[model samples]
Target chain A: MDLPGIVHRAGGALLGTLQHVRIPGVGQASVTDDPATSARRWRAVTVLRDQAAVGTPEAPPPPLDRFGDRIEVRLTAAPADRGTELAARFRGTPSEAEIGELRAALREAKQLLEVGEVLRVDPQPHGQRKPTPQGAALEGMTEQAPKEGVL
Target chain B: MKAATWTGVNEVSVEDVPEPTILNDHDVILKIRQSVTCGSDLHLIGGYIPFMRAGDVIGHEFLGEVVEVGKEVRDRKVGDRVVVAPFAACGSCWYCKQELYSLCDNGNANPGITEGLWGQGVGGCFGYSHAMGGYAGSHAELMRVPYADVGTFVVPEGVSDTRALFASDAASTGWMGADLAGTEPGDVVAVWGAGGVGQMAARAAMLLGAEQVVVIDRVPERLTQVRTHVGAEAVDYTTTDVVAELRERTGGRGPDVCIEAVGMEAHAPGTPGIYDQVKQQLRLQTDRPTAVREAITACRKGGTVFTLGVFAAMVDKFPLGAAMNKGLTLRGAQVHAQRYIPELLRRMEADELVTEHLATHVMPLGEAPEGYRMFKEKDDGCVRAVFLP
Candidate 1:
């Protein structure tokens, strides 16, 4: 990989680590779970629909169903008529990339079930992006944003 | 398409950016009519937000005509004149269901940055920054609005484009502060800024039956507008002791509700102001809480203090002890424009909410750089520099 490519990836990695840093007033509570435990834990999205309508774990929605037997999917009712909690976890210890994919898939599934379409942002509108390291770093952060969060 | 963009700190540039297209089925393309500069946009322009990438489009409050709509869109079509909510909230989200549209879970596509900063993702705001959603702003000839059914409101025929524009964000935000802060009839309400939002909040308070409404600001023109246009009394904080004045006016009870419409880059007079400025410049604090602190201090015992301003992060010396001791209720939110835009438009139709005076400077999109300069410096009595794209 080239120098700029490495720096961009480093910026993304920095964003990935931000969720784990515990700052009393500035940042929220840190996610302290070990990587293996974190990967094993269920990542869920609350879809504002009925459990039956969200499809069974055996036959989950499209992008989620793509994971197939490689992951375990759960469909449960959310309280107060909010929706159904669609959750998934890798059957085995998954790599960081796999977990990121899972996160994106769950978000997409929720959006598709609720709004009937997933929202898109890129290729919308913008001017020139000067090739500064800081701009690249921000681009890296935004590129990694969809796959990283408290979800 | 030509668009106004944040090229660098304290700089705005007009660039030939690609025109936006429908990205979601619920999205609509707007041929922007009037997009105004918001005070919150200053934070991004000054690089206080830190999330704005160079060349990012940067205006949110606007009125436009829909030229195109995605197939799934309902209640809106081509040729409809509309004022859109700043936040792109899916109507089906739990937060949106509760009328808290700004907190819609699915609105922001890139939630990680904000989830990391604030522990939870907020709904996306158009043209704010990448942290919000990176949606192109209204400062362009054309822009895309997501969740069109939920966020965009049809302008009543009688209301002028200039009158319905503020209903998008400033009016909605100000009304939210007054209503959520629980301004009651015969109550004394004090708002601590005379910017577009502050002036609107004063108007909202009066309409909500507050007996006496006082808007505080140092800007002579804004203060005059507060008295003349909003029909609220104005207080010049530079010459008056704000706390003392509120106490005196309210028969020593202080204001029943205090709203702070000034955000992180708040200006203050004298020593405390200097201290905040120095600390902010030195990076000890991210925001200048001068107005927020005063609001907490000046609020009556058991009164509510609502911040209608846009604050990014933490501030030092927030006067939490005073808040707790006085039993003050503190609240703040991004403008839930969808919740109040309808009624605000109706008020605009009746000519009760006058926002045309707030558009003190109006120009075409090509002159955005100069317009932003006038707005940032508060030069030429520029309340809001409205851009016709």
Candidate 2:
């Protein structure tokens, strides 16, 4: 559908506004609109890793070393909210290629469903047992036979 | 200088005293060439442990040569080197049968045991007052030990008497605290207090496979010792907000286990001894001193809190409801000295654990008063003070 113009514009504008600039302080960051619920949701992650800061001349931050392995991220959204933003956190633990692949997979899943159609995103496809109801709607649901109990 | 006695508060002396002979067929007369004062000994002199009086021998944890043994005691010899686990058990009661000998059921095991001492008909202890179980301690040149066969462990070769002494009480208590806290690899463990027992618990946690151990202490020297030797991180609870610090360290989930090594004297005069009700108190709030509280507050959901310290004689209340609410299991116990000695000694023999590092000062038995003062004030990195009688 030769829509490079629209896709690049959306990606570029979002990237420019979000790059490297952190809020003065983020209070109560929620993975979902209601973080109280344990379901899939769109997530916000912050860049906390700074390999350059360790053993450097700075006095070290009070909340220091929360970089790299200690980097923080949270997920939000649910099958009831629609599967459009399922496993947004899956990108945080992957390489560049893996993240691109995950993004493409989410896009494909979104497209496979009708606009506003419901879908269940298995938050941890690799985890053993049960698909999270995510934001799936019963109608227009692409129910694949669950693979023999996450085995 | 062959015998020890309490002359006054913070005063002790060695005098020409009668030597001990086996009274029971199960008894052993140990010629104590070495002995030591514990922090609890201060309780006896200051009258804090309650019901202690003049002529009471001082010290509880020590190692020595077995000078004589009765006909019923078969395992030990006159010359055999042994480390004593001062707590005794009846070995047949429900608690003892389950290998929980420290909680043994005996006629004297009851609260009314002020008739004489603890464990007289049930189980007994060493070096504590008549309220505890009127048994003489090892901090003397001569001492009589009832139930000697069950309480003393033979020191294996190459494990010096210097090192084996702690297998009696401090080291075992620490190991049991870590064990009760359910330590596992990759878990974060926080121990409150850096006393002899606290540091030992930290070391035991490391040996049992905890990935990180955070030892909380106001005493700088003791904390430094723990950080340098046991690989445990340190927390100066005096200035730092301990609760916030622990939460920050543990992925906001809290430590996997928290051990209370501070027992009663976590704060000053009002609180005393180890805690039995900390099992209940831990349910209320997690805090620094009453490590049981901190353990409850600091543990991850579905974690374990072990109280190894002895609480004073008040039926204090704790948060049993919180423990249940948080889905936590809290265990209360005194050290099972009868059982853990051999296993602990093997670790020492293999050089896998060096408990002697805990012994920071040593003096002749006459200076036990000085030893008592140093340990009570916690001077000179005073984790342990050994008395060579």
Instruction: Using DockQ, give the best candidate's number.
Output: 1
What is each candidate's DockQ, to 2 decimals? 0.79, 0.00
Model 1 ranges off by over 4 Å: none
How much is the lDDT of residue B208 in candidate 1? 100
lDDT (tens digit, per residue) of candidate 1 on B1-389: 99999998898999999889888789899999999999999999998998888999989999999999999998999999999999999999788999999999889989888888888889899999999988889999999999999999999999999989999998999999999999999999999999999999999999999999999999998998998999999999999999999999999999999999999999999999999999989988999999999999899999999988898888998899999999999999999889999999988999888999999999999999999999888898889999998
Which lDDT values do the candidates have, in the order given?
A: 0.92, 0.59
DockQ computed for model 1 against the true two-chain complex using alpha carbons: 0.79
Cα shift from native, residue A36, model 1 (Å): 2.3
Q: Fraction of true inter-chain Cα contacts (below 8 Å) kept per model?
A: 0.78, 0.00
